[model samples]
Target: MKLAELAKELKIPTESFIKFIQDFDLELSECISTNFEVKDDFAKFARENIVFLRKYSEDLNQNKSIEDIAENIDQPKDKVAEIIKKDKPKLFDNGKYKSSVSSFGIDNKLGGNYKFVYNYFGKNTHLAERDFIGYRDLFFFVSQTLEPYLSNISVQDWGIHRPAGIVLYGPPGSGKIFWAKKIAEIIDYEFKEIKKYFLGISFVDDQKITFNDFLIQIMKSEKTLLFLEDFDEIMSERSEDESVKSDDEETKEIILHYISHFEKENILMVGAANSLEKIDRELLAPGRFDVLIPVFPPNMKERSEMLFHHMTEDLSPDALLIKILEDNKAHQLPFWLEISKKMQAFSNTMLIDFTQSLKKRIRNLYLKNNSTTIKITQKMLDASLRDASSKLTGTYLDQIQQFIYDVSLNNYEDFTVRIEALKVEVEHYKIVDEPTKPIGFTHNDEIKQKK
Candidate 1:
C-alpha cells in the first residue's frame, strides 16, 4: 500500500506517518526533479514532509477513518488531523537531505581532478538598498524574476514559465554577492555560498568530475536556491578565449543543457558574473539567462540607508546629514558604515560629533589616496557596485570624500585620527570580495581608481 493509504487505514495522522519514517531512517523509493522526473536514488532517504505529501497524488486511494488509523498506529487521532491540515507543498525534496555544498569546497575546475563543483552564489537581499533607491525599475525586474519562483510552491508543479534565468554581472566589490544574499532572505529562502578556487577535476581512472559537475548535481535541488556567486570564473567568455576553452565548453554545454531543460514550474537558477561582456554569449541567450540584471554600487539614497542600517544609536535622518552624504561619490552606505563603526570604537559621541567624525574619516580615506580610494578595492568591493552611481554629498559628504582622498595620497597624518575623531566602534565588514578569503586588504591605488 502507498504511504498515505497506510496512514489512513491505521487512523494515524499523516504527520505521524512522516515522523515515523524519519524515526526509522528510511529513504524514499523514487527521487523526483522539478519537472516530476523520478531520478535515481537508492539511498532511500525519505523525508517526513514528502512521506505525508504522498497523499496529493490522484493515484492514491484512501478508505480509512482517522480514529481507526490512529488506534492501529497507537497514536492520537487529533495529531493525525493536525499534520494533514498543516501540510504545504515545498520547493525542496521533502525527505532527501544532501551534505551541504559547502563541504565540497569552492573553485573553478576545468580538467584538474575534481568531478563536480558546487559553488554557492549570493542571494538577492544583498542588493535591496539599491532597489529602494532610484533604481526602482532594476529592483522590480529582479523581484519579478525571483518572486514568482520563490513565493509560490506550486510553481514547482505547474506555473508561469519565466523564460529568463537571472544573471547578475558586474565588477568585484560591487555587492553582487550581497544582493544575492539579500534576495534569498527577503523571500525566506536559505542562503548557499560557493567560492571559485576549490573547483577541480577528480577521478578513479576514467571516471571524472568537476566543479561544474558538482553544481549541476546540486542545482537540481528542490525548493532551495543555488547561487553562482562569482560565475564568471568558470562560465566566462574570458575562460573560453583562454587556454581553458575545452573545459569551458564542457561547463557551457552543461549550462546550455539545463537552460533548455529548466521547467519554470520547478527550479530557479541564478548566475552572477563580474563582466557581462566577458560572459559566453551562448550562456546568456534567451533560453540560458534571459534576464541580465546589473547590480551597481550604492547611490546616495542607498548609501545613506546602508549607513543608517549599520548605525548603533539612532541618528536623525536630518536634511543636513543627508545633504552632506549626497556629495561624496565614493561614500556609499557600506563604506560609511565601516567608517562609522571605526570611529565609535574610540568613544561614544552624539550625532553632530559623529557626523563630523564620519566626514573627517571620509576625507582621510579619499583625499590622501585619491578621491576614489575607498577602504575596499574595486575588485574587493561588493560585485554590485560595477553599475552603481554615487549619491552621497554635501558638507559632511565632502569632508568624508576629502578624507578618503587624503588617505589615498598618503597625506593624512594618522589614518586613525579620523577613526579616533568619529569616536565610533569598528565592526566586521558585512560584504566580502572573495568567498574564500577570510579577510581582504584594499590597496591605496586600487580604491582610488574609478570605473
Candidate 2:
C-alpha cells in the first residue's frame, strides 16, 4: 500500500507521518520505498499502532512546554526538561517548544518502549532495490508540491495550479539539476535545457533567431521543462555596484514577459541557482519563479549510503575490490558510519571524489604488494579523506551556511530536521584557534606578566 493511502486509512496527516519516521530515526528504506510505497512490515506496524500514532501526531503538531509533554507522556517534569535541554530543540516566542521539536525523539531518549519500531526493520531492503539513497523527505516534498500536476482534482477542486517557474537553489554539487529533471519526470514533461547559446541570438535551421523566438518554438512543441542554469546571475536584480550583461537583461525580460503563458502552453521553467540572495523580487512574484526548493548536502546516513554505493557500484561479486570490501565489512553501512561521520557537510561530489581517491590508493597498494589479500587500513582512509576535504573549503562552507539561512527563512517548516542538522555541521568549522603563549609560561603566569 502507498504510504499516503495508509495515512488516510489511519487518519494521520501524511506530512506528520513523514516527520514521525524522521524524528524516531526509523530506517526509511526498511519502512518505505523511495516512491513512498509502504512496505508490508511498516503497514502492519502502523495499523497495529493506530492509537499510538494518532497521539504522537497530535503531540508533534502542537507547541508544548516540558510540563505539558511530561503530563502527556506520564513522565516527571524534571526528567522531561532534562531530556529536552539535551536535545536543544527550537523554542517558540511563548517559551514553549516548536512542533519541529519531535516528542518521539524526547520519548525515545527517556527510554520509551520503541523496540517495536525496530521490529519493522527486520526485513532488509537492498540498495539495488531502491531508486536512490536517502533524501526520502525531499522526494516526498517534491511529490507534494507537484500534486496538482499529478492529480487533476487538485486543480479542479482546490485551484492549485502547477508552478510556472521553480528555482532549485543550493551550493554547487548539491545536485539541483537532478531535482529539476526529477520534477520534469514527475509531471511527464520532456526535459530540455535552455543552453547558453539559446539565451542569445542564434541561427536555428540556418534561420536567424533570438531567445524570444526559441521560447516561442518550445511553446509550440510538446510539453517541455525548460531548465535555466546560473539562474541567480541571469535573474539577478540590477545594481549600481555590479554591471548587468545586456544578454542577461534581455533574457530576464523575455522570461518575465512569457512566464504568464508557460502553464497554459504546457511548459515549466526550472531555474538552477547557487544562491537566491541576488535574484530580483519581481521575478519571484506570484505565478513566476516563486517556488524555491533547496537541495541539500547528504546527511550522515546518506553519506554512508553514497560511499557504499560508489565503492561497490559495478564491481563483480568475485572482483578483488569486492573481496577486500567484504573482508573489511566495508560493504555494510555500519562500516562506513564512522568514516561518514567524519565527512560531515561533504557534498555529493566530494563523496564521489573520496571514493575515486580511495580506489586509486587501493590500486597503488595492490601494485606494490602484488597481493589480493591487502587489507584496507585507517591510514589509507585518512589519506582519501584529506583529498576529499580539499573541496570542503571555507568558501563552500559559507555557501552552505547561506543555504541554511535561506531555507530557514523559506523552507524551515518543511525541512526543519535537515536545517537543524546542517546548522550543527556548519558550526563545526567555526572552532577558533587558541592564542599562542610564551614558552615556559603557565596561564596564570602569562596573565600576571601582562599585568
TM-score of each: 0.38, 0.82
Tens digit of per-residue lDDT, candidate 1, span 214-324: 667655665445577656656766544475456555766665766665554234557777555456677767666766665543333434444444332243556333343
Pairs that collide in candidate 2 are none
Q: What are the per-residue Cα lDDT tens digits for candidate 2 across 1-451?
A: 6666787688898777777776676767677754456888788888998998898888888998887788777778898898776556779888898875666767777888888777766455577555577897788788778766665645776688989999999999998988998888767889999999999989968999999999998999888999999999998999899888999999999999999999899999999998889999999999999888999999999999999999988777788898878878888889989899998889999999999999999888889898867788999999999999887765677688788878989998778778889988876775345325211113434346869
Error at 291, model 1, angstroms: 0.9
lDDT of candidate 2? 0.83
Cα-based lDDT at residue 372, candidate 2:
66
Off by over 4 Å in 2: 1-11, 23-56, 74-121, 152-157, 428-451
State how far residue 11 of model 2 sits from its true place (Å): 4.4
Quote the RMSD, in angstroms, for model 1.
22.8
